[model samples]
Target: MIRLFITRHGQTEWNLEKRFQGSKDSLLTELGEKQAGMLRDRLASQNFDLIYSSHLQRAYRTAEIIKDNREIKIIKDKALSEMKLGDWEGLKYDDVIEKYSKEYDLFWNKPHLFETTSGEGYSELKKRVIGSLKRIIRENDEKNILIVTHTIVIKQIMAYFEKRPLEKLWDLPYIHPTSLSLIEIDDEKTNVKLHGDISHLENNVKEIC
Candidate 1:
């Protein structure tokens, strides 16, 4: 059996500003750091055999905080990075909606039909994210693993485990910054123990944007 503890990075400056941070990078806000500390406390007792994080600074920083003094090795991988937004990177939500109305609409409402000229679409994102996940599972069969990645990456991972179709990508249970999810895999069976859980944040569960 393999236990995977997956989490999204802490809230970033772009996240607070409602900007698209795809492929781009941003620093974690004060609240973001606090959230990571809280997560650290929440999982302090658990032991992780290995930690995999997105090469992006935001996710890597979050992983560092959660790892906190632990001796676990953190491996950064581009496959765990956020969906590349290309021209949409570093742009505000409304601006992207205004500048690329059709594509933006398709991105949010019809992700399965969404396509991008400069960046990757949902299908492309899913392929890489899921492929990385499978690779991790294959390499570490009976160990506890921690993966720190982006929102879309985590969502795609959860959707894969839930057997959800691309059309229902944004179903329910929003993936908040620093949220923790757990998946238990044994042989051919996969079980999701938690999805988009913010219990670690306790009363400080207000969404920034």
Candidate 2:
């Protein structure tokens, strides 16, 4: 059996402010750092054969915290980066709606109509993210693996394995920051669940934006 443990990076300033944090990098907040540590504490005992993370600072930092003193060498993959939001990056939630109505409307509520002006297209993001995931699966050869990535990437990966169409992506539960997901793939069957589980955070779980 193949065990795929996927998780999102910790919270950022933009996340707390409800800003669109596409490819733009942001520093993790104090709470964010704690979240990563909590997640690490939850999974530290597991024996992962390989670890991968996005090249973005937030994700890389979370991976570092998770790795801690472990000998694991995390492979930073750009393909796992979050969706680039073009001019929408760094814009506040209300600002995005008021400034870029056409794009923002579709981006939040209508994935089918969402389109980035100077960023990546939906198909492009889906293709690259899944391609990278497939490559990892092929090489790992059924060993347990850990993937540290962004929100959109994790959503897409889960959506793909769950056979959920893009239009229904939001139908699934919102994946909180530092949330963990487990995807199991094998010859006989493939299973995925716990898309946004943060039970590891104890009772101090902050609301994820």
Top candidate by lDDT: 1
Cα misplacement distance, residue 102 of candidate 2 (Å): 2.6
Quickly count the clashes in candidate 1.
0
Q: Model 1, range 1-209, lDDT digits (tens) per residue? A: 99999999998999999999999999999988988899999999999999999999999999999999999999999999999999999999999989999999888788988988899888889889999999999999899999999888988999999999999888888898898899999999998999989898957654743
Name the TM-score of candidate 2.
0.95
- Which one wins on TM-score? 1
Which tens-of-lDDT digit does each residue in 61-173 have in candidate 2? 99999888988879999999998878888989899788888887777688877876688877889999999999998888769888999988988998888888888766667
Error of 1 at 178 (Å): 0.7
Sliding window of 10 residues with minimal summed lDDT for model 1: 200-209
Q: In angstroms, how far off is 184's CA in candidate 1?
A: 0.3
How well does model 1 score by local distance difference test? 0.92
